[model samples]
Target chain A: MLKAIQNLGSSTTTTTRTTTGFVASFYRLKPPHATTTSAFVSISSSLLSYYSPRTRPTKPLLFLTRKTLSLEPVRAHSTRSESKMDDTSSSSSVAVQSSGSVRKINFCQWCGGQTKHDIPDGEEKMRAICTVCGKITYQNPKMVVGCLIEHDNKVLLCKRNIQPSFGLWTLPAGYLEIGESAAEGAIRETWEEAHAEVEVVSPFAHLDIPLIGQTYIIFLAKLRKPHFSPGPESLECQLFSLDDIPFDSLAFSSMAVTLKLYIEDVKAGSRKFHYGTINKRPGTSPSDTHGYTLVNHLQS
Target chain B: MLKAIQNLGSSTTTTTRTTTGFVASFYRLKPPHATTTSAFVSISSSLLSYYSPRTRPTKPLLFLTRKTLSLEPVRAHSTRSESKMDDTSSSSSVAVQSSGSVRKINFCQWCGGQTKHDIPDGEEKMRAICTVCGKITYQNPKMVVGCLIEHDNKVLLCKRNIQPSFGLWTLPAGYLEIGESAAEGAIRETWEEAHAEVEVVSPFAHLDIPLIGQTYIIFLAKLRKPHFSPGPESLECQLFSLDDIPFDSLAFSSMAVTLKLYIEDVKAGSRKFHYGTINKRPGTSPSDTHGYTLVNHLQS
Candidate 1:
């Protein structure tokens, strides 16, 4: 088992072992996610460790008992293993159960598949397995991440080589890689698509796209050297000032939202971190009771 | 097929189709990743989608064309199916060979695991894929998030539930969930373990924990309606003033680092936001510069 370990805060190690007892390691750990400021309140990883994959059923019987007695109802697992081979455009239902207490009858919450393993085991928790992936699907939020690469007075952008927007221009951004820090992935992505050597400055934006099942953290970074070339993943690479941004040609709604916030920050001469993505357009204040709706867009 | 679609900013409909033809749509979509910010950014499913369960070589080409010839070197794939039952403890290697291009091996630059994947024929741009999970892994940063639940001038504290210093006392905090927004998750976590609802007043502390695959984002929230019960996640929950904090029993190296910063900020009256977690600590800062070193304290 080769182990690649990077320590954050202090010297600590995390090891993953292969049968041959090989270990791999990584270093200079930074916080996985951050805002414009890296100064966050301290929270330990004790509780987080409970959710680790290696976490066993410590008192499985107690957990089972709690499962059986919970107020929620468990449905029967009704579907079989049949690959939903149709195009993603084709509609199909395969029910998958979530590990959590909540269970809905009609469909799997995450993938919109039919509920297959909705069995009320001795424990009250109903398990719905997805007919498509054969794994239990639950309403889990997706991870979103991206980088803000600034060179000179302009920002670098890429015309996506993939879809849902194939040829749209945007920053180098994507989802968080498992066991990777958001900053590391962001910098890595910058290198991959834009072929640029960059230094992550600070985390700038954090937003939640509830509609699409993602949470995003956009970071501010500067190119170590301005020289760059487009990678296979990018159709084109170029830099643009705030006014010259190709607004209509940007990919995904969130990118547009982030860019808008970035421009606003620059205009206001404020570099503080901002929450809520353009996708959700969180109301004016975090403590407001407007019930998560947009009152209006602040006209530039 | 049940579809969970959100409202598109433009006319683009957030439509999801299931394998079955029945689609149930939600008018107001849930935030993508539990947090109230950011949209989900995923790799282009169309261009990058490969090695599906149904992947099969079609009819051999009769005449190789220019574009096909250009892409020929990328067609090379390992004939080995993903090993489902191999001993996970053993180290492995994955190599991609194209006709004329240099053969590339997929492994972690840090731990040397067979967890790297070439990015769709791109050179020096492959993701580290975890062999055990058969998914790509990145040497990423860790996230450290926690809440500041204060009552009267005193704040809440708890002994470590699990960990390096299991009985150490500190403020309640943990990792961000898979699909949760940091603030929402932080607040929800405070209520879950501390049985308290606190409005996060200002950004507090941010620490980059690149070493142990962690980052810390601590929020300074004010307590509201203090009546509460300690959930199962905590060992004990109590309130303490700055003078009353148990520095000796604090959990995790970062907690002391955070508390010091917190106190510094409190004293300086700089409630806006701080940059690093333990910049005040000299010895602990090395891991911050060199990445986290894994320790055995995490083992159950």
Candidate 2:
């Protein structure tokens, strides 16, 4: 595992196996030009001590590989995972603070021109307008696709290896990529997170978590085979009966509500589908007791 | 109606009543400093003639207000409406061309700093990275919410007064706002376009049009009263029996399929809810016969 971390570095500086049998891989931080020398040194020292062998045993090992690092900055897993591993929560705090500001463009990617923020003629909202190339940039909500996989009277749950809910169980889901249908995205996320093939039955839940700027489209799917294992983003993948579900440790409130709805419907013997919205109050942790409110319930 | 158009201009520059008695209001083009002279002249000439009274009779009267301009650049409605009113299609063509390019930020909206476009350290895709503020900007899909309103054995339809499918019939719908539930957005749109309140019964159809980067959530709804008329975004609102339904003139393929499903289910005495996706092939008009394919179906 230490060798894997060494490979992640562009050029490895040192590698050592500690007395505790944990590998310590150290690489020089390639700070961007804008990073101050003092800031770089401070960040590096903190990172080093955080990854030292003494601190390794208690932390989840999911972030030790490059595959897990492929998740984007906007994802809940990325924010949560990094905050836990790093002793300082400054980075995660910065991300959270920036979420409130409008997404502004500083330089044009096409012409490298300075941009202005204004509502273009005939447009309603303010947009980033290129000062040189006259290009207009817009921001929209992202689609997060996942599945509620059911098999043999049990639902599949993966113990997340990354943050925002590291070590907590969740349905297999991730950000939808460009050029894919919602169903395809959901199936892909399931396979990527759980190493399981699924046959999507139907669209089960449409949740708009506007606070995170994501609209999660969850499908009710069936496991194609009984075999399953944890993928890079998951520490463990297992089938949990209703009685065994860990509601307290669910990764997201949306997942908890979805699972609860599914369980209750199953008990009633009338498994109707649901579509609605989930809103998390500002400044409240998603896992907070009063954090999220389900505003609408549409059942069929 | 002509008087309404005159009121739209900040300062009345030129207003002409044509032989058809339609008022053509032309405002001076206030191009941004970055816009090239030739581009401004070309865009203005086309826009002027498009809104001219001679061309007004054939088009839907949707673009007669500032509220409609609040629609974003990502929507098919914006592209279609602009092209129809502009006459030359050059503006629409320019928008289509820009769609393929990355959304660039030239000046950071937060700190007025330079920005770069590159795949961020841990992400799979390229994004705008602010140099001064260290902000990462991301683009995502937009949600379009609407309703399938039924009353007294008749389905309500609105003749769109806006562009894209101007003059064509459609269920009342619009872009989902920043802080609203999908059901709230759908109900609001129905009221805004048809002057009728509706109780959203359940989720009816979930269609993902990856080509336009939209996820449309349609609901089964009930009209609160027998009274409705054309709202600002609609030219005519009426209830059509199954035999009188206008399939060929429906505004969107997803709407057509949803209506068809509703009709078929009603005839079978099983108004089961449907969940599925609709994918449109690239470069094909949405109205094209082979443009859209429904991938999966889940009924209850």
Among the numbered candidates, top lDDT falls to 2
State the lDDT of candidate 1 residue by residue for A62-117, as single tens digits: 10100000111222221211111100111111111111212333332223345463
lDDT of 1 at B81: 15
lDDT of 2 by residue, A167-209 (tens): 8888998766443457666776777789887766656677665
* Residue B293 accuracy (lDDT) in model 1: 21
The candidate 1 chain A region of ten consecutive residues with least summed lDDT is A61-70
Q: After superposition, how far is residue B17 of candidate 1 from its true place, in Å?
A: 50
lDDT for B173 (candidate 2): 78
**Chain A (candidate 2) TM-score to true chain A:** 0.67
lDDT of 2 by residue, B93-141 (tens): 2333222223433444445566675656644445556687676544444
**In model 1, what lDDT does residue A173 have?**
74
Q: Would you list the C-alpha lDDT of every candidate in the order shown?
A: 0.40, 0.53
* DockQ, every prediction: 0.04, 0.12
